[model samples]
Target: MGEAIHNVIIGNGSAGNGAAITLRERDPDCRITIITMGSLPFYNRYDLPRVFRGCYDWREILVHPLSYYDDHSITLRRNSRVTDVDARSRTITFAHNEVMHYDRLLVCAGGQGYLPEELSDYRGLMSGFGSFEAAMTTYKALPAGGTLVMLGGDMIGLDLARTLIDTGYRVVLLTNEYTFWPHRIAEDERDGFIQALGHMGIEVVDGVHPVAVEEGEAGKPARRVIFDDGGDVQGDVVMPSYGLVPTAEFMLGSGVDIERGLLVDPMLHTTDKNIWAAGDVCQIWSAEDNAYRFYYGWNNVRLMGEMAARNVTGANEAFEGLEDERLRIDKKGHIASPFWEH
Candidate 1:
């Protein structure tokens, strides 16, 4: 017998976990390792907002416990951020300058919250809902009935806004070009969403562009979003939710084709034969549209991981995206999307 193949997956989100489990099931004896920047195991990112509801217990959101990976003989390298990828040498470089080699590699690092250029300098003042730690920080910062100003509301932040409002927190939504991102809508749809947000008891402020952010006055803890038109919105905490940008910075200079995201074929195979990519970190080539497109949503991302794992394990499976993730606004101005659901 020859040496068993080593498979390395970068990410611990739905896509990475899904791929890890599938790879083990398909190729029993193959060496499997998952590298994640986060310390905890796979957790439902959608449920991260539950922290604001006073559920700081991470166990409630975790998909599987630590023993699950151990029982399956899968290595979980937590807090390991990949800094570089050498496609030719088949090595992954970590931030600590440690390097490791893999026979097969899959990139599913996912995306990060996009902060607008205007508010870039004030990133330290704002809280985020992207990760467990960020959510907890935001939760701790707020007092009873504390106001939260969403600089730009994306679907994720909007979902969190609803929870914040119901939990006795004031939410001011400042709409911008990136609102309801990953899903582009018509003017009517946008109007419908704005109306719906108003009915949901959120203060929807539109037509203003944010230019900068400022800390609150002495003896008063708050964040102020300064607008281009000399207007501003003040709140206890300001969270920027412009949207997400692919977390593919490490893939740059790695000899893989990248455009907004790592470009991959229907098989999830990158330009390099030894590597594959999935989830929000990749833009799949859509032959029908003759362009590379990104598919979002929980189910879609998980399926992408599974398909990529299969292909990595010697199965030539082509990924047909799982969800029709288009945003829909009804006559009643109710917004509907799989992302808003479990």
Candidate 2:
């Protein structure tokens, strides 16, 4: 028999894990290695906000335990960051200066939280509500009964705000948009959401932009958010809830096509036949639109990962993307939208 194919997956998020599991089930003899900068094993990122609110601990949110890797014969390398990729050579370099070769590579590095230009320099001062570690940091930094000035008003931000409020932290949410989920919710729904937030004792500010972040005194870190309107809000902990930006910096000059994200065909194959991409780090080619478009949400990402794995394993399956199902959380913290709506 020929040499066993070594599949290297650069991520440990939903997409990466999904791909790994699927690949293992499909090709038992293939070698698989999953790398991640995070120290923890694969966990439910959807429950990260709950982690911040004390609704779930780190162990509780983990999707699979450490033994899952051993049981499946999958190598899981945590705290290892991929620094560069050599597509021509089919090699990837890690932050520790180690290099590894792969017969097939999956770029599921996912996305990083997008901080505004003004707050970029002040990243150390604020907490992020994105990753599991970020949630833990936010939870630890939040003072009892103190104010939390949250930047951004996206769906994730709204959910985080509700969690904080329920956990007894006074929250001040800042958003440049006129309404939450402008592309998804109607104007009346937006107004109702704002009203609901007020009733929950959460402060919501719309149509405002943060121009700068000011450092705090006495080791309190950055506590002030300066607005474009010349107003400011002080908080014990400042958290940013901005959306994600594709984490494909390592693919630069690696022969992988990247525009906002790593470009992938309908089958999720990259320009390099040996390379594939999925999850938030990939932009799928939409045949109908004749352009690359982002497919957000957990279900879409998981499906993309599965498709990428299938294609990598010699299965010719085209990813048509998710249907009209939308997942929305109501004011009561329940999933109001049905699964079929997505």
Candidate 3:
């Protein structure tokens, strides 16, 4: 007889979609809405590399067709960027100046590739691999048998390099302090990983710190990544892989605690009673350890979303992080990691 409960989710990635689906199933009569900045529906980011193989079909990379959301009675609002989150008012203000209210809210906005202030001058020239559009852009920029100069190394970038090399493209990864993200490579493990990458035909240049990007000479079409030491590497495309910084700037001034990321309890509930956060946008507090930690990787993120949804629907489920964090090199000098298999 009363108004139906309205549930809103920010973001349309793996964690947000996972939560939306579970929320609808648990509360069939409630109104479910998803707000995302992306133009497309849920797609596998890991599958973005398939585009390099000449598979330009976007549908092949989609995790769920657009109709899947319609069938589940979930409203998907694409291209709608949230400008602010007023926790006390329980409202979200969009970039278009539209404000909407919600009964329960979930934040799974995730993170984005960050170029530190020192590299700010080269932001415009840097290509990306974080989304479908980025992948397409990189694909279009690269010529046949072209080279990609990766400014820094990360798991996803390394994975992309592996795919690029298999397709007869060259990749030169510039070593930096933030090379391997989410996994801190020990001194003992570094040689093996670098050697494995070499075995894969990926050129690993060590101790090079890039400071700027510049256009090539009059006859050359390549871009140059200028090092701090005046040396440089030329490539068809340059991508910065310094890892992701949590996309939680909009949550600022909302009274929700944020340190590196949104602070949430083990149940994914923020300090605000009506809101919950999951995925890369949040740091979970560990009572036993007395520290807040971030759990990266797809398996952990997907589980976080499902658990957050259940907790939102009157269930008490604590997220126990997944165990896909190990990285190792095989006898054949091949790098193996559960993180890249995604």
Candidate 4:
């Protein structure tokens, strides 16, 4: 509204999409550019489990196709990653050495390397369970009758457990808690899950916090999991779906406030005011910079994106949180959307 079309969304995930739509809703004349590290067509990263199980194609897995963008008058730059963010210059550098200038920038960079590695570049081994390529790669590589030891009992891990069982792989899921999903799951639900898990041939042993994951068998005899509670579980391969650590490395040394993610007020404005972060990469815990927090699924991303879009377009908007939202598929092929507390 001042000089140029004033909004740029970095990352084409749900959060970025939400920001774009919200900005456009507030100001149609404002330009919206979505930069994605992955290939074209935005999909719900949560749908990767079904993809791994071969339940759906990549296109079917996507939330919205390219046509949606064209219909909405959105400009998308997919199949590329943004390498650097220049706040002072108000530009984003892409992997192809292209520079995108922006009046207002919203960073929705999302997930990063979560698994611990043996080498200093251990970040390389921490492949995300999301996306088309990752699902195809991981599922196709899973050997039938081979032991699949999974770390973490959160939504992703549970979904993966269901997927591996359906694909004929023996699963051994270990977690620190004595019971799976202790925070919200009730006794009846847990029993049903246990029954279903046993029916699916999954062996879930609890209170065994995985201290180290190595290649080979589990326990004292073979290369196995040594838990914090001093327990052991042997297996052939280990897949960790613990959680996502925000992929905000590009902001390093940028002097933009970062509390796990880009520090922003409820209005989504960063310390620089011109910059913002959406999705799991924003400091959403407090109105002031404090603890860092995040949530899974597309709804949060969509809403976050919308909020950022509005802010970039000069209308200040506050984000409450995606605190209770939950979208998960159980072993019986039923989709549940009950709001859950982490």
The better candidate by lDDT, 2 or 3, is 3
After TM-score superposition, what is the CA distance of residue 216 in candidate 4 from its true location, in Å? Answer: 3.9
lDDT of 3 by residue, 1-342 (tens): 998898999988889988999998899999989999999888888778899998797888889877898899999999999999998899999998999999999999999987879989878888999989889999999999999998777887888888999999999999776677778788888887888889989899998888899887776756998988999999989999988888999999888989989999999999999999999899999876789988877777878888899999999978887765778887777887677766
Root-mean-square deviation of Cα positions for candidate 2 versus the true structure, in angstroms: 3.1
Candidate 4 overall lDDT versus native = 0.67
Cα displacement (angstroms), candidate 3, residue 248, comes to 0.5
Candidate 3 ranges beyond 4 A from true positions: none
Highest TM-score: give the candidate number.
Answer: 3
Task: For each of the candidates, give the backbone clash count.
Answer: 0, 5, 0, 6
TM-score of each: 0.96, 0.89, 0.97, 0.78
TM-score of 4: 0.78
Which stretches in model 2 have alpha-carbon errors above 4 Å?
Answer: 53-57, 178-201, 216-222, 325-342
lDDT of each: 0.88, 0.80, 0.88, 0.67
Better of 2 and 4 by lDDT: 2
lDDT of 4 by residue, 247-332 (tens): 88877766688867777777777788688888878877563446555545566666777777777766776887655553444666
**Sliding window of 10 residues with minimal summed lDDT for model 3:** 333-342
Supply candidate 3's per-residue lDDT for 156.
Answer: 79
lDDT (Cα, tens digit) per residue for candidate 1, span 201-312:
8899999888888999876657788888898888899999988889999999999999989999999999999999999999999988798988887888999999999999
